[model samples]
Target chain A: MTKAVSSQPKTKRGIERRAKILAAAEQVIGEKGFAAASIADITRAADTASGTFYIYFSGKDVLFRELVEDMGRATRSQAAERIATAANRLEAERAGLEAYLIVVRDRPMQYRIVEEARFVDPDAYRTYYSEFGKAYADQLQQAAERGEISAGDAEVRAWALMGIAKTLGERFVLWEEGEVDIERVVAEAHQFICNGLAP
Target chain B: MTKAVSSQPKTKRGIERRAKILAAAEQVIGEKGFAAASIADITRAADTASGTFYIYFSGKDVLFRELVEDMGRATRSQAAERIATAANRLEAERAGLEAYLIVVRDRPMQYRIVEEARFVDPDAYRTYYSEFGKAYADQLQQAAERGEISAGDAEVRAWALMGIAKTLGERFVLWEEGEVDIERVVAEAHQFICNGLAP
Candidate 1:
């Protein structure tokens, strides 16, 4: 994958234009998929000249990586804010799951784009999840140490929790045509997470 | 998606040939992905003439769907057999998860092909998971009635458990370079499933 050389915008106009192209790319690629979507299509969606795309991204691949990276940043920051206000690790999990579902519901395209990254740009896909997994494992480890939760394999628990959130977000939020009952879904799942199936 | 109308082969030899082609397609498509794996490549891998492929499958798409469908059948049968031996839902969950991980380890290609179905054939992907999720929810409901497991919302808990198995299989079995410690991973995750993170 060719890395984009132009990292920063020199002026306000340049910054806005770059952001415009990235946003357009996300929509175009997310809908049409990475293979079918063309740079021309993205430029058309952005209402910008085809040449202007090069001014920001070297090519479509760079813009895709950036989009995936941007989603990671956006979700992590959002979850971090919600989690920080929680009383403990279990509460943090609830807050984080709710925040994640909201993000998926609001920006369904971003979720599609990230999933498409698995096939379009394998490295970016791996990096995105690996980084998230690392941070999640760290938090779980700390919680276990503090006796906030039952101790087990932090890495396994982290991945398991991530899996639950991801699958639920896909099945309930993204795929559902009608408005999903996010509150009810979260509350039920939270119960399971707090206390397992043992009667 | 154009559905293939070809019926089963009449002769014993013809049946074996068709089976060989499907096996080859699994390996070829699983390794090279759907877009990159051509019909010719699959035929070559099967050691059959390219024309023989058409005799069995209308095209690559039909063959791909068949492969995915075959995997679902294989997994469900295997899990059902193992789960039957379990005493209750918790034991069933342990057996089911263990069975799933073993399948991933033994037939990693089938796992990859199923995931690739999301992009290659979206409907098949949805049907695969939807059917699994519905059955899982039913099982959970029954278990709750029998006092096998404490269930709050069967659908929510079913999806959560599925998610845990899916992600763990991906990270620990499919992606691991070294031998995966299946016993240890299952034991740790099972503990979490039986008793949640509550202190």
Candidate 2:
């Protein structure tokens, strides 16, 4: 395994350059995929000299791994922020699902990068979801104890809920033709999440 | 997109040869991924000459598309069989989820190949899930009419349910370290599916 490079850059100029390269990388790699997207392409897209790429990272592999990790953090933080305002676990589920769908719509490249990681960097992909799953399960467990939700296996429920958000995002938001009605998807999916299919 | 090869075999021997090639392709392609696994690798695994591979398929891309289609059919058929005996749509959902988890466990290669298709053959991946989603939504719509399940957006519900099964399969079965207690996972997930998290 290639040891991933540091995302942190020291100087403000260095930081801006690094951020540019990272943003360019997400565009290049997400569009062209990890194997096909070359460092030169990324650096070119970043409008930097080819050598500037290595100043921030080791290689494409390391940068791809970082993208996967970055996506995980961004998504989790976004969902947490949305869920923070919810009145209860049920409402939190609704807010979290809505936040996820919106993120997929707004930052489509992040979703592509993370999906690509399943093949490009299996460990990073696993870590990304596993970390998110663990955190989600912990919250679910607490919610169950508080009588905010039904008691069930937190781990299984967490993964299942993650699955719901994921597939719905893919189908309703990403694959939807013409104008996307994310609010409608969130409402319908949230009802299923809270009440399920029981009449 | 390269036109996918015909999965249908003309003769008995042709059927056997094609099946051999597909089974070996699944093993090779699933293990090594689409790009890394060559027609030579697949033929070698099949114990057939490289020239023989051309008879069954044009190239790796065509064969991969076929594999994705095959996986979709196999999973849908298996789930349908299981759901046939279910007393209601809710029961069908349980049987279907269980059936899906078992397929992922037993035919782990198919799961890997389909995931690979997200990058390798985006159209096939979309078609694969969309076809399944449409049929699933149709079932949910009918079930709602019969009052077997709650009235909701069937399309939204179908994809959400599929998302649950897909993620749970990835986490609990395909990624499991050892002996898998699939029944337990199914029970836990099905409970949430039918009743959701509302206390």
lDDT (CA) per prediction: 0.89, 0.90
lDDT of 1 by residue, A70-138 (tens): 888878888999999999999999999998888888788899888888778888998898888989999
Model 2 local distance difference test score: 0.90
Clashing residue pairs for model 1:
none
Tell me the tens digit of each residue's lDDT in model 2 across B25-121: 9999999898889888888999998998888787788888888888887888888899889999999999999999988988999999998898999
* Model 2 lDDT per residue over A65-170, tens place: 8888877777778888998889999999998888888889987888999998888889888988998899999999999999999999999999999999899989
On the 0 to 100 scale, the lDDT of residue A79 in model 1 is 92
* DockQ for candidate 2: 0.93
Q: Please report how far candidate 1 places residue A99 from its true position, in Å.
A: 1.1
Candidate 1 residue spans exceeding 4 A from truth: A1-6, B1-3
